[model samples]
Target: MTKKIENHPIEDVFGDEICEGDTYFVFGNETVLQSNLKQYLIEKQQVQCYEAI
Candidate 1:
């Protein structure tokens, strides 16, 4: 399953009422986060992405 947030501006992706400083918790194996170059997203957006086991 996949969801795409396309055709949206940066503000819409992370600003209030959207991401709103929320943490995107990944409920999967370590490889799940690593597979999609997701780490780069941290540096890219300056937000936190936590993974749960």
Candidate 2:
């Protein structure tokens, strides 16, 4: 609720818009992470990803 919005202008804002990044993460090592988990199990779903925290 933005703390009831009293004097809520530039209070060290970190949520009102300052996002300049996208996210994607798949690691490698053990033979390329087992070949990308066998290409994500030959087809997988469920993706809505974001991370800057």
Candidate 3:
């Protein structure tokens, strides 16, 4: 017999803050990509890193 596995909702664990904005660079492989993208966005948008708030 197979047993059912229970999974918790992400919001339940992370809370409502998870839904507020975009979150990048959570993965190791995506580090370089995130850095490059962040730089590009900063340049193209001419915005400061703190401006993301």
What TM-score does each of the candidates earn?
Answer: 0.25, 0.17, 0.25
The regions of model 3 sitting more than 4 angstroms off are: 1-35, 51-53
In candidate 1, where is summed lDDT lowest over 10 consecutive residues?
A: 8-17
Local accuracy of candidate 3 as per-residue lDDT tens digits, 1-53: 33232431233212222222333233332222232456645755476777554
Which candidate ranks first by lDDT, i.e. highest? 1
Give one digit per residue, the lDDT tens place, for model 2 in 11-52.
111123212232212334111122244444344434444559
lDDT of 1 at 33: 28
lDDT of 3: 0.37
The per-model lDDT (C-alpha) reads 0.38, 0.29, 0.37
User: Which residue pairs show collisions in model 2?
Assistant: none
Weakest lDDT window of 10 consecutive positions for candidate 3:
8-17
> Candidate 3 has what TM-score?
0.25
What value does the lDDT take at residue 10 in candidate 1?
A: 30
**Residue 45 deviation, candidate 1, in Å?**
0.6
Name the regions of candidate 2 deviating beyond 4 angstroms: 1-20, 29-53
* lDDT for each residue of candidate 1 in 1-53, tens digit (9 for 90 to 100): 44444432233222323333322323342212233346545765467888899
